[model samples]
Target chain A: MEYVIHLAILICIYLILAQAFNLNFGIGYQFNLAHVASYSIGAYTTALLSTELEQGFIVCIIASTLLSALFAVLLGGIATRLKADYFAIGTLAFSFVVSALLINWKSLTRGVLGITGIPRPIIFGRELNENLDFLILIFAFVLLVQVFLYFIFRSPYARSLKAQAEFEHAAMSLAKNAGLVRNLSFLIASGLAGLAGSFFAYYINYIDPSSFSLTEMIFVLTIIVVGKPGSFWGVIAGTVFLVLLPEPLRFIDIPPSILGHMRQLLYALILFSVVWFNKANLFPVQRGV
Target chain B: MSLDILPQLLINSLIAGSIYALASSGLALTYGLLKILNFAHGHLMMVGVYMFFMFNDWFGYEVIGSAIGCIAVIAFIAYLSLKIFVLPFTRYSYVLSFVTTLALSTIFEAWISMQFGVNVKSLTTGFQVHSIEFMGIFITPIQIIIILSSIALLGCLAFFIHYTPYGRRLRAFSQNEYAAQGIGVSKTNTSYVVFIVGALLAAYAGVMVGYETNMQPTMGNAYTIKAFAAMVLGGLGNVWGTVAGSYLLGLVENLSIGLDFWGYSIPAGYKDAFAFMIILFVLLLRPQGLFNSKSRAA
Candidate 1:
């Protein structure tokens, strides 16, 4: 029961992540590879505030979410100015910068030893220490974020984003500031990703640099691509499908060491096949940049 | 701080830059022609280095011969990757190609780890023991060989691209694919040659890295990023320009190792970050890259 609840909580966290990714890459048509960096900023922020500052849950999550948003603003302000392909490269550099900071800033991040004993959230003056309690909290976050995402998708802003994605000139002709919309969307999605990261740090009771690497970005990208981005329900299904795909392999009698790599191998192969088969609909020549 | 280390650092920079230059030219050129990022280029080098290791240990092949064989294997993989995964995606599927290459990179890393059990292996051959000293500074024969090899390879490539008929056709195709095709260049045959040469060059860079530093699965990623920095620093598609960029990158990267600031010394581990910072700075200040006046933004 605990294992199943653990899996559910993880899925909840990932649903928020995949949805946030969807809002940016899917709706905004911006390929920000630094999503993981913002996510890590949230994690590190929450971890540091809670452990170093001895802050409460509300204070930690809010502060981290805001900090992550601020970083998104700084990163997006510059990154979104570039053309599409260069935007990816710029964000990738940002991701590496964040990663370098996390790994090298021994003074702040503790340099890969990671923060430990991160307390579970205390809600309504009661500590939600148990796995079940955390699941409820995670589920709440997932629901709240999902609702927010739904509104964003339905809002007038989303129409502009849609127009911008389909054709920037068309969006411009309609008096939509495509750059402003993109930056704003990038900000919101990064903040949400931060929220997801906070929940992840809280639930796992641990935070490490390894959890937020380029591999994590690849995993999210796979979910968005496989789920057929631009559809909320499709992304949700993708998150669930991919999160659970490796579980059955765990039950098989494989050695513990090789099993970990085997799962990644499977993911790589699946990602390759997905792109190979879905090439035309995915990245058409007309959408070159 | 002693001033003696500066000269050594300069030499180290030279070595590091050439390493990056050798590694990145193929990736930059492939991206130039096909618009595919070739994320697996570094991993292909890692695999090639391992092949060199296997050939040396198990097959008892000579060092130069094994290096040659490494090129052949990677060329095949490059061609296969293009044909099997990359070419199927119609023209201008940049995102698809990028993601596919990224996926292939992951596969290669994981596959290498699974096969080799994540153990680091030294790849220096019997012939790598000799060194030459100048002005009380010692340099290995292998380092000189690596440096000279990069220069020769880049020179040969530039010559081929400019002087050879097929190479000119390939460049013409790169500049304007439809125009080149209209002019009767065999686009298909040229693409094969491009893939083969690009793969071979990247593989050669990998073997050189493995020769100096021991082989490890994770090493490919760091070098790949460095190569990327070098590539972008020099210019995206210009061969000689990238070579110059590589040297500059090597100097900065090596100089950062023992860097002192305000009485606080920076750790060597932070060296790679300097390159990434350069990349971010370049991407923002001039996305066309330092040496590139023409925008390769697309």
Candidate 2:
């Protein structure tokens, strides 16, 4: 039962992260590879605040989410001005900068020793230390985020994002304010990723630099691509499926050393095949005249 | 910190820049021709170095023979990747190819780690290290060979792109795809040639790096970013610009290591961040890159 609840909590966390990614890559056609960086910023923010300042859950979550969104302003401020192909490269470079800071800023980040004993959230003057309580709290947040995402997906703003993604000039001629929409979407997505990161820290009780590498970005990408990018329900289904797909590996007698890499290899292959076979359907080209 | 180390620093810069040039040229070519950012380019080099290790260090083969075998193996892998992961999406979204190649990189890293136990491995060859002193500067024979090899390979790339018919076809294809097809350039054939050549250059760079430093599965991660930095510093698709950018980067990095201004020096841990800084600054100030003035912004 504990294992099941743990998996449920993980699924909830990834669902929010994937939805955040879905907004940028799936809806806006902006492949911001630094989504994991935002996630890391959130996790690190919560980790530092809770451990150092002894801040409560509300303060940590709010601070983490806002800080991550602030980072998006910096990332999106530069990324929004670049061409499509260059946007990915710029975001990737920004992520590397964040990673470098996380590693080299030894005084602040503890330099890879990683913060431990991160206390779980204390809600309603009660400590929610059990896995079940955390799962329930996380699942509620997931529901709240899903509702927010659903409204955004249904709004006219999302239509503009889709329009701009399909053809920028055409959307611009339609008076869609593509820049505003792009920045808003990026900010929101990163904020949600930050929120998820806070939950991750609270649940795991430890946060490290290794948890948020480019490979983690690839895993989120795999979830969205497999679930069919731009589809709201598909992302949810993907989060559930991918989170559970590797569970059976634990039942096998494989060594722990190779097991982690085996899962990565599996996801990489899955992502490659999905993108390869769905080339025509996914992100259809919009040739300019 | 004195003038005595200037020559040494310059020599070191040249050596580092040569390896970066080898890595980024192939990256520049694919992005130039097909608009495909081969994220796995450095990982391909990683695999090549491992293959070199398997043949030379493990099986006691000669260096030349092992390099040939490495090239052959990487060439095949590059071709297969292009055929399967890259080419089909050239006409489609560029982002798709980018993600696909990113996945390919993950696959390579994971497989290498799984096969070779995540431990750093160095190549063992029979050759002895010998450094020659000229004008108070010392350079090893391997370093000289690496520099010469870079010059020769880059020269050959220039000649091939400028003087060869196939190169003309590639240029034509990149310039205007429909017009090139109308003029009888086969996209499949051109991409095959481009990818194979780029992979070969990367293989050589990987071998050079492995010979110079230790080998690890994630070693390619830094090179991938460095190559991207070089590519962006030189316009993204401009081959010659990438080479110049690589050398500039090498010089700047080495010079920064030697000289400290304002009583501050870059820490060892932050060395990798230098590439990101260059990239971020370049992308912000001049997205078209320094050498290529033509704007590609949409």
Candidate 3:
């Protein structure tokens, strides 16, 4: 039961991550590989504030979201002027810079030792320490984020974001500010990622650079792509499918060391095969409804 | 800094920069010709390093012999893989190819790690620690080889791209793939040759790097970023620009360490931050890079 609840919490965290990434990559058609960097900023912010100042969970979450959104604005301002591929590369460079700062700022981040013993959330005179209680909190957050995303996805602003993604020149001719839409989408996506990161740090009670690597970014990307971006339900289903798929592999008769590796291989193979099978429809940006 | 220490660091930086140039030049070629970012380009280097290690271990080949063997083997494998797997997806969207390459990168890294444990393997010929004296300056032989080989390779590449028929065809293709295809150039064959050559260059760099530092599965990650930075700095799809960008990066990093006049030094880990800052500044102020005349392409 505890293990199931733990998995549930992780699924919720990833759902938030995948959906947030989907907002930009899927809706805005901007491939921001540095999304994880925003997530890391959130995680690190919450971790620092909670550990150093003994701030409550709500304050840390809000601060993380705000800080991450500010960073997104700056990064987006610089990157939105470039093309999609350049934006991806820029974000990747940003991720590297952030990761380096996290690792080398030993005075602040404690370098590689990583922060631990983070206090969990206390709500309404009740301490949520048990796995089931944590699951409920995480699930509620995920639901709230998803609902907000759903409304945004249906908004006129989102329609323009989709239009810009589909054809920037055409959208501009149609009187849409493609750059502004791209920047706004990026900001919202980054803010949500920060929120997710805070929840992740709180749940794990620890945070480190390794948890927000290019590999992790790629995994979230895979989920978004596999789930068929731009569709909210697609992202939710993708999170559940991808997160659950690897679980069954644990039962297979394989060496403990190789088991983890085998799952990675499975992900690679699945990603390749899916991209290949969906090649015709996958690459072209879908028009906003 | 002491004069001796300054010279040593300069030589070291030059050597490292040369290797970075070698690997990144190959990446630039593919990007130039295909307009596709080959994310597996680093894995091609890894395969090269692994082949060199395997040849030396299994066949008792020396470093030079193994380097040649590694280049040949890597080129063939890359050619075959491109022919079999990537060619079929040529008409597909660019993102598909990017994702496929990324997936291939993961598969290759995981496979290598599974085959050889994650421990870093030493490939030194017992001469890595030895230094040669020239004009009262001490330089390692490996460092000398790295610099010399880079110059030679660049010269050869310049010759190939300028003087050879295939090179001319490559240039034409890169200028306009559709036009080249309209003129009866086989896009498939050109892509295969370009990929193979790129892999060969990357493999050669990998062997040299393995000799300089220990080889590990994850080494490719750092090199990938550095190569991308070099590619962007030099102007993507420009070979000469890549070489220039590499030296610029090497000098900046080396000179940063050299400028610690008050006995205060920047930590080595901050080197990447320094590089990132430079890249960000360049991208913001001059997105076209130093040599790039046109606007930035992805």
Candidate 4:
């Protein structure tokens, strides 16, 4: 039961990330790879606040979300001016900067030693000590985000995003504020990623630079791609399936040493084959003049 | 603070720039031709370095022999990767092609770690480290080899891209793929040649970098970002500009470490961050690239 709950919480965290990422890459066609960086910011913020300042759950979550959103605004400001491929490269550079700070700002982040013994969230004058309690809290937040995203995807704003993605000039000629829509979606997506990061810090009770590296980013990217980008129901299903897919590896009689890499290898192969088979069908080809 | 550190820093910068040039030139070519960024480009470099180590260090092959064997092996891998991982998506969106390379990168890193263990391994060059001192400057023999080889290779590339019929065909294709195809420039043949050449350059860079630093699975990640920054700074898809941008990056990165500004100097650990800052600043200030006059083709 505890193991099951752990998996559930992991799913909840990834769902928020994938759903948010879907809004950017899937709908807006903005390949903002700094998402994991924003998530790292949220996690690190919560970790520092709770460990150093003795902040409560609400304060940390709110701070992390807002800070990540602010980061998104800045990132979007710099990267949105570029085209798709350059935008991806630019955001990737920003992600590297964030990772550098995390690892090199030894005085604040304690460097690679990592911040440990992070206190779990204190809720309403009570400490949520139970694993089940944390799972419930996380699940509630996930549900809220999913519903919120569902509405956003259905709105005219989403249509504008898709329009801009398909044809920026056409969307602009149609009087859609393409820039504004891109920034708004970017802000919301990164903010939600931050929220997920906060939950990750609380649940794991330890936060490290290793957890937020590019490898983790690839995992989330795999979820959206496999689920079929730009589809709400698809990402949700992708999240559940991918999160649970590797669970069966535990029962195999492989050495623990190789098992971890085996999982990564498995995911890589899956991602490759899926993209290979569905390359033609995955995303609509960007319309050119 | 003194003139003393200038010579060493300049030499260091040159060495670093050469590696960056080698890495990014291939990236620029592939992007120029296919408009796809192979995220696994650096990982292929890593594989080349390992192959060199296996032949030179473990099997006791001569230095030149090992490099040749490594290049041949990497060429085969490059051909396989182009066919299996990169080519299928050429007709589709470049974004999907990018994702495929990303997946390929993950596969390479994981497979390497499982095989070699995660420990950093050093390349034994079969000789003691020898640095030649001239006019208050010290240079290593291996460093000299790296710089010379990079120049030779890049010179050959420039000659190929400018002086040969094949080169004209390549340039024509990058300019207008449909027009090139209309003139009977086979897409498959062009992609295979460009892809293999790019891989060869990256493999040579991998061997040089392995000589310069300890080998590890994740080493490719930093190089990929650096190469991207170089490619962008030089102007996306501009091969000559990439070389200049790389040399500039190497100088700036070295200067950040070697010189103190206002009693403060950037730490060596933030060298990669400096590259990122350069990308951000360049993208914001001059989207056309720092040196390039023409804006990139949208």
Q: In candidate 1, what are the lDDT values of residues A1-289, reduced to their tens digit?
A: 9989989998998998889989898777787889989999998899888888889999988997899999999998888887656677678878888999999999999888998988888999999988998898889888999998998889999989877877788789889998899999889989988988888889888988999977888899899888886889989999999999999998899988788789788888888888877777874343333
lDDT of 2 by residue, A190-215 (tens): 99999999999999999889999999
DockQ result, candidate 1: 0.67
Estimate, for each residue in B147-214, the C-alpha lDDT of model 2 and write its tens digit: 99999999999998999987998888768888999977888888899989998899889888888778
lDDT of 2 at B105: 94
Model 2 interface CAPRI class: medium
> Runs in model 2 with CA error above 4 Å?
A287-289, B1-4, B130-138, B296-298
Lowest-sum lDDT 10-residue window in model 2 chain B: B257-266
Docking class of 4: high
Stretches of candidate 4 above 4 Å error?
A: B296-298
Kindly report the docking quality category of candidate 3: medium
User: After aligning candidate 1 to the native by TM-score, how far in Å is the CA of A61 from where it should be?
Assistant: 1.0
Query: Which DockQ value does candidate 2 get?
Result: 0.79
TM-score of 3: 0.95
Q: Looking at candidate 1, what is the lDDT of residue B266?
A: 75
> What lDDT is reached at residue A38 by model 2?
97
Q: Which pairs of residues have clashing backbones in candidate 3? A: A86-B298
Computed on alpha carbons, the lDDT of every model, listed in order, comes to 0.82, 0.90, 0.83, 0.89
Candidate 3 Cα errors over 4 Å, as ranges: A285-289, B1-5, B84-86, B126-129, B261-264, B295-298
Residues B139-201, model 3: lDDT tens digits: 777778889998999898899888987788889987888899898988777778788888888
Comparing 2 and 4 on lDDT, the stronger one: 2
Question: Residue B54 of candidate 1: its Cα lDDT?
Answer: 77
Model 1 Cα lDDT, one tens digit per residue, B1-298: 5567788788888888888887877777776676656667788778788777778777889877776776677777878877876777636446777788788888888888887778888775665386788986679988998888888988898898889997788688678988988989876677778877877777777778777878888777777777778777876666666778888998988887755655677788789898889888887677677787785553
